[model samples]
Target: MKIGYARVSTGLQNLNLQEDSLKKFGCDKIFTDHISGAKSHRPGLESAIEFVRSGDTIVVWRLDRLGRNMEDLIRIVNQLNERGIAFYSLQENISMDKASSTGQLMFHLFAAFAEFERNLILERSAAGREAARARGRFGGRPEKLSNDDLRLIKTLADSGTPIKSIAERWEVSRTTIYRYLGKLN
Candidate 1:
């Protein structure tokens, strides 16, 4: 069975080209996503993965259509190969069926490239975060409560204010109030 997967980065782009090629290749079923490949979670891709079985082939219009990066590509293809599935890319003209020596070599190369790409991304991200920290910036979400708010919350708790009442007043959970009070003491 041939299962086709098509993707477009945005809603503005059309899947017509990929769809036509997959259909021309005589795909039994085609799954599509109108979302960015950068997103790790894709419903169509997941569905296609889940739907396929051993001896099934997943066909894509191009290599990039299937993954956000080379690391992601290797992950997906390796997963399929481990399950006795094959992958076919129309534009690249590559078929990986776990039999051909060329296919095996290509896959090993993909693995190496994926590793290099992953490392480069990590290095860049770490450098960017360090630069941000140097400028008095930080990563992660901003705090829900400020230092002043925490002190006030402590004072309120000390004055015999009910936890539930304080929580209701600040639109925060009772656990939050408890946490602040505990930290203050």
Candidate 2:
């Protein structure tokens, strides 16, 4: 049996094209999801995986329709393989069953390229951060309390003002006050 999976990023997107392709490809049953691929929990995909048997094959309209990223794609393919199932991507024309050596090679090559791409992205990100830091810029939210606020806080704390009262006046938590005082010391 061939089980098909179709997905659209949002509820507004149509699933017709993917469904038609899957049906034409001879899918016995098709499961569909109308959610972002980045989301980890997809009920339709889970059901399709659970519904497959040992001799079953899973088909998708495109490789991206099945997974959000390369890592996810590799994981899904590995899971299908472990369950004695085959995976076929219609647009890519790749099949991962025992008979297709070319398909297996292409799958591995794609996985490797995906990993390489991820590493390059990480490296570029680190470099960008370093460049920003060199210009005295930093990431994350700006400080909520100004230098004047810090001075007032330190003075009030020194005068033995109640921590809760200080926090309430500043519209902040007691922990925030403590953290500021710690930084002062």
Best by lDDT: 1
Report the lDDT tens digits of candidate 2 across residue range 1-185: 99999999987899999999999999999999999999999999999999999989999999998888888888888888888888999998988874478767866887797899789989999999999999999999998799999999999999999999999999999999999999999
Q: Write the per-residue lDDT of candidate 1 for residues 59-107, one digit (tens) a residue.
A: 9999999988888899999999999999999999989877678879889
Clashes of 2: 0
lDDT value, residue 6 of candidate 1: 99
lDDT score, candidate 2, position 171:
96
Q: How close is candidate 2 to the true structure, as a TM-score?
A: 0.80
Model 1, stretches more than 4 Å misplaced? 129-185
lDDT of 2: 0.91
| Local accuracy by lDDT, each model | 0.92, 0.91
What are the RMSD figures for all models against the true structure? 4.1, 2.9
After superposition, candidate 2 runs with Cα above 4 Å error = 8-17, 34-41, 98-107
